[model samples]
Target chain A: MMRLLKIVLLVCLFFGCDKKAERPSAFLQTQQIKLAPPRVLTTSTIIDSSIVLSADFKMEDVKLRYTFDGTDPTENALSYKNPIQITEAGTYSFKAFHPEWTPSETTTVKIYQKGMDTIAIQLRTKASIKYPGMGAKGLVDHKKASLSFTDAEWIGFDTIAKARIDFGKKVHLEKITMAYLVDTGSWIFPPENVIVYLNKTDSIRVQIPNLKSDTLALADVEIPIEKTVQYLTIHVQNLKELPEWHPGKGLKAWLFMDEWIFN
Target chain B: MSYNRRSFLKQSSLATLGLLSGPFYASAFSSNNNKDVIIGHNSHRYKVDLGWGMLDPSKTPVNDCHEMVQDSKGRIILLTNHIKNNVIVYDKSGKLLETWGTEYPGAHGLTLVKENGTDFLLISDFERNQIIKTTIEGRPVLTMDYPKETGLYTTKNSFRPTETAVSSNGDIYVADGYGEQHIIHYDGKGQLLNVFGGRGEGEEQFLNAHGICFDNRDVHNPSLLITARELNQLKRFTLDGKFIETINVPGALICRPVIHKSEIYFAVLRSKNSSDFDSGFVLIMNEKNEVVSCPGATAPAYQKGELQELYQTVRLFQHPHDVCIDDDENMYVAQWNSGQTYPIKLTRV
Candidate 1:
């Protein structure tokens, strides 16, 4: 019995069972865990004229605060009870707040207002049958596709895609904005270069930059078209081969386009 | 001598108290402590053990840990695409015990079934376009090729099976998820019995039929639960091939359904949105098919009997493919394309 007690005591001491529990450092910042940012439901950033902007967060008693004056949202900002209608263009930001948790990161969405109307559009090259979209009319429909390529709003192409836009008549145009998808995981890449023919003689080219991250996103490429003409032809070159660092290297990359805004 | 004995007893009891109260205090006071990242909601919260199942990469490299299963002996089995070690067996404490198999290059789904008091493993290899059944010791017992009798395919390459489910009577159901989206059923003798579900937008059709499982909770009224991943819904079919109901989990791309006791668990591969790539989480549903908890994501909320859209609130998991629940209610999550990392264990709080 005496030997057993000695063994138990030695085991307890080896395990440091008698050590005093040290308190956490006083220098440690005492703060609540921050909540994740609220979801920005308003996906269409570039609109024709007006849009209904909204955001949602389902946590109980957690309110979504927002500001439309190009400023970060704070506790003093207006609490979002319903969707806000924006007739003018500006930047909108939203943040979720709760009494017990720290405020979430600010989510920003920039809304562009200027959109030139187009009478008709004709496609020279057809999109892939898998991603048929709503046909060529989807380009001028003013409906932007979310970052997801499977939303049917995007017209995907494995080859160079060309589209010809015809305005009602010759009008003053300063620039042409085109929106495309960038999801590297799905092998969808931005166009290599976008060529916009203002007319049969003069044209401008915009080269897409190489992506630095593997994140999925939507990008808008603007081409400077100072000359005004009734007809505009656009040639979007698909990335012929994926980068060497990509898993699907040496394979043809896909090109997804959602909308084209003529300004 | 009597006083010394009493004093020794007192010291020993105090040491025991200190050791027992340490973990209890750490968890009880975790709300105010930022050291532990507790996830999930309601009565299903858990803390992640990232270091669990981590092995020496130089010895046993993994490409994508696709699925996991716990055997009757309480041993955890993981299936990865890496041919060097396709299946790695580990203890509940994440100690590597054994490794085997080099032929399952596209190892995706793993299901364990007990028959005649012997445990068998069903491995779905999409790359090889077949379902291979083997003993627990890595010996092949049977091999099921493409369902040629279904007349749904013109070539073997078109029948990429992703998941499988076994009925109580040994009937096998294969979900050709990456193929033409059909569920092929066969008897225990490997004879094709029936086939249903094709790619369409109808109620009985499935888009990306990624996973399938037998729902034997109600023994008399067992059904099959299949996942239409792209549509973000779980479709239930009667024993034969009749559509019952669709459980909508909006904004969550669930990979598979793992039923444990009275609840169903799923590894949400990613959020339904296009922007967030690594927004994956684990979802739990009660017996009534209502989402009760979502770990690494937002709390489950419903309005007017319809579940609101669910998204990732915390970036904990990246493309989690499967979930394995042990007898102790702990969960092991296997991921796909997540930097080739090992399975992460979530200990119940």
Candidate 2:
């Protein structure tokens, strides 16, 4: 106890004598304690093939550790040396650490592959520049849709978006699926209805109900396609007006969606 | 001594301005002198002058240089919390004209008003929980204690006033930004006329109501412009404290509203969602209420008529608390927590 007291006194004296011109403030202290997670950069498209995954951090001295088994990355996890070669698809999550900084926010990526082959698609209207959804080719890129509307893979539309896929030749398809992000705070809402034209005359449709919460969520809609067709078109509608609780109340809502997978 | 007091300072010991040896006189100008010499965007660009108002710290030191105002004579008045000189006056050329006052320990807000051809200053001290009206030369003329008549405060400390504004009718409106976020109005005689607003998220309430100023631009319907710093919003109210409108400038933690012809100029203390180090800039808006330029930050970008979040693009300023624009359109920026440095001048280009 005497030795500990002496050590504490010495530390206080040392710090007291060192008249540094600049010192850490209360705001910096709080920020250092609030650990920020790291970023896991991976494309949403998944093909039945190997992929590469990497981590991005703001600071150079930060050390990254990652895991691929759907578990949170710990400091003891495998130290990130280079981009991981992801041959097996799963969840890739990572965290960053520094000696003087707090741990970074945890980030994860989903690895998915295209379920089908030999398909050409075209979008009628160009995507919004802010959220281009990584271009129309991203729909059939075999990548899964992400929940974050800000993701480069999510295509944003001002009012509505229509996509038509040409198989070139007649093909057999069973399931049609697409992912959407629902974040009401940013004026992004789920589509009011999703309609698919199997041919020209006959069509099937699915409606998304009104959302009550402001939390960001992902909605993946899947429709079973038992008929064989040469061309398939998708019509996703945007919300006309936002709810009353939001700041942009009664304003036109934004529509954000990721890749459309046809299996 | 050479004009560069900084060079002389480097060769001396910790002694000057009745101040002891301390780290407060740490380097002020950033190392990248060339890049930081010029900043701003669009037609409102400015030539940065970091060397302006450089004083010998041992003689006239400052802590948290909060607010600045230009008088009719074109002289600049700076308010600081340093006990040695709560008020420092300067000329357009950054020459020290005078310094006075040891009463204001937490001198946070300074508002200059001309009444009957005489200029007076409203000094708000949060530490003393009072607003003192004094002549430009630092003679205390009137003292206003906590507003017990408002029934919002039980003690003086609970009424820490941050800003005060004088109307065209000579009515003094005090905004207790640090304490209750209440706007207390009183006749020039210091009798409480009325009180409105409190702490809340509603349009009528405020969080960190840091500033208040009278908008006489609309001669027919003058109003008060107040700041809600935490929400990055400026709430305008009628002379009687009626809510008029809320102008939202996202990512900008504004200090006070300094109005010029066809434009409103103010210092953005810092930007929200930015690293907490001194991410500040000067924001200017046209008469149409559209942000025209952001000096020391990236040019303002809007999407679908909505302004995007703004962050620091140039490291010219650190926590700029107030901006005083001269008749020539030049700007003087007073900073907070910026190494006890003096005000920086931005010459309009």
Q: Residues A51-156, candidate 2, lDDT per residue (tens digit)? A: 6787654333568888878898877988987877777756677877654333544566656546676678889777787677668887767665555565677788
Q: Poorest 10 consecutive residues of model 2 chain A by lDDT? A: A24-33
Write down the TM-score of model 1's second chain: 0.90
Question: B1-349, model 1: which lDDT tens digit per residue?
Answer: 0101001111122221122322322322233433455778998988776657777788987878899999989999999999999999999998999999999998998999899989999999989999999999999899999988788788889998889999999999999988889999998767899999999768888888999999999999999999999899999999798999999999999998999998999999877752445568899999998999999788998999999889876445667899999999999999876666788789898
* lDDT by residue for model 2 (B1-349), tens: 0111011111011111101211122221111111223456677988765557878788998978899999989999999999999999999988999999998997988999799999999999999999999998899999999999777789998988889999999999998988889999999979999998889889988988899998888889889989998788889999999998898888898898888876888799876654333567899988767788888665777788887777654334667899999999999999886667788788887
Tell me each candidate's i-RMS in Å.
Answer: 22.6, 20.8
Candidate 2: what is its chain A TM-score? 0.59
True-structure RMSD for candidate 2: 17.5
Score chain B of candidate 2 by TM-score: 0.89
Give the distance in Å from residue B179's predicted Cα in candidate 2 to where it truly belongs: 0.6
